[model samples]
Target: MPIYSSDSDSYDVSSSSTRLFQRERPLHSILGGGRVADVLLWRKKNVSAAILLGLTVIWCLFEVFEYQFLTLLCHIAITVLLFIFIWTNGASLLNRSPPKIPEIILSASAFKQVAVTFHAELNRSLIVLYDIACGKDLTLFLLAIASLWILSVVGTYFSSLNLMYLGFVAIGTIPALYERYEHEVDYLAGKSNRDLRKLYKKFDSKVLNKIPRGPIKQKKSK
Candidate 1:
């Protein structure tokens, strides 16, 4: 019975994943499954996208022959640089000045659909939050799995995986910290206002009653 249940669960999980990858969005990607983001992200200059497509074609042709490390490196390098340029510019495009605030936020929402780093961080947060909310045993189990995965990857890929690990950690932590800082400012402002109100009431009831009069006009004369 237990084995049958496990098999059923496994099938359900795989089906869900397959469905998710099959979905589509306009430009960036088709709901995270990855797509040609011509309309979504690459709406501007076509030059970069054209070059990337060209290189991808070449890479594919090479791959048909065999997996050449040089070809792999060339393709990966181009893709990585492409992403860096896009993200750096995308951040600005996502959050323009107050005049285009609405448009910017909307773009960010759309961007999130294809933003791989954002998705990865969100998934990480969900896993951690779930473990914390569930129970200590579950949390420990998750931690063990996470630690083992990191150890194995880093051990097996000392050079490449090390950079990937650092990149993920940095990207995940930075956004979260920015969110916390914004919240902290809001909290402090609220707390200060609340404390000020209490002090006014506690010290002098008339304080609230007094009119906040402007500067008294000096009696003309003397």
Candidate 2:
């Protein structure tokens, strides 16, 4: 449809005109991305930190010989720590890379493999850190054996019996110990995977940057 304008400059009052009108109009509606992931991430860290703090306090009490509540507090503390560490690191490590077309086209197995790989690496890193820190506690088991030996040789055979018994005792701590080990492994895995994911995200051409939703125009400084 041809529309005539009497003015010197003619504007095509069609699709182009509608576009110009849209360009001039300001957005009254709010724009936002979903915060579900971000909120969950924050909760992951905060809850983990809170758990760790509480566990530390309980362990301190346990060390002070608070026998009345030692076993309960100690086990609970370790359990909570275990869960928190796994969650905090897991959430961070699991990167949402833009889907790869070939992989999706060829097989879903490729996507499954990607998830497995990310999890494996994160778990490995967490274990390494856990092993290093808990090593000292593990050493206590060895030291207990040594102390028991010296007691048997120098003192009466039964005099240091209780202390010697504790040498074999930390065997009870093994599960909690391993739990810590696993926690650290997860952390390490996540950290390493996250770094690798970041590198991949930066280099991958398919992952395009989103543009601002508005007309582009050159602005001059006043």
Candidate 3:
């Protein structure tokens, strides 16, 4: 028998089980089930912390300090080149072997594969957008419109860099927190979903169904 933990509103099961929004898959599997998931979930705590720290420093440099990316890149390159130049000269004077830099090459096939994948994904997104615009699915169309409206509202408040940093922070923290308290999160999510559905039904019956409509022409089978 497996041990079960219970809270006032949520129950945790220590076994393979489906949860809301997880689509019958484990959280780790849903997150790609590899090093990426490990880092996101804090399985590699040091790596995750280091990545967050690095991102925070970059965000601070760009947003708080107003550093331009190209200027920073050139400064970094100059510093690195200067250090290497001095090291090589000092090594020659000391009769020591200079640093051996590995050659970096861009593979054509890898680039082609990436381009092809990007093209396919872009086409797929365009198709979805077209369908939504065409009103192929009313619910999906409404959802897309609502999402865009929310994004636009958010954009009014935050700059692009601020939004990006907030998104990065959310990505770094939300998944680990969800995995830790998934039972409670899923329970609350399910409850909220049910409530939303009930509200939608009420609105549909009261408002949408009350709207005047023309007679629908049924498609005839040939």
RMSD of 2: 29.7
**Per-residue lDDT value at 124 in model 1:** 87
Write down the lDDT of every candidate, Cα atoms only. Answer: 0.51, 0.48, 0.82
lDDT of 2 by residue, 90-207 (tens): 7657763432236566787967887886798689868755765576554334445677688668666443433333433343333234333533433444444446566656755445
Name the weakest run of 10 consecutive residues (lDDT summed) in model 2: 25-34
**True-vs-predicted CA distance for residue 191, candidate 2, Å:** 23
Angstrom error of the Cα, residue 57, model 2: value is 2.6
Candidate 1 residues 1-222, lDDT tens each? 111124322332212222211333321343232332332233333644465455556545554455567867888999978877777777777884322235766786678765976788699879966776576664346456777789778777654434544554444344334333533433444444446556757656666457586898988996
lDDT of 3 at 77: 99
Off by over 4 Å in 3: 1-18, 92-97, 102-141, 217-222
The alpha-carbon root-mean-square deviation between model 1 and the true structure, to one decimal in Å, is 23.2
Model 1 misplacement above 4 A: 1-109, 112-135, 138-153, 161-222
- Model 2 misplaced regions, further than 4 Å: 1-45, 66-222
Local error of candidate 1 at residue 198 (angstroms): 60
TM-score against truth, every candidate: 0.21, 0.17, 0.74
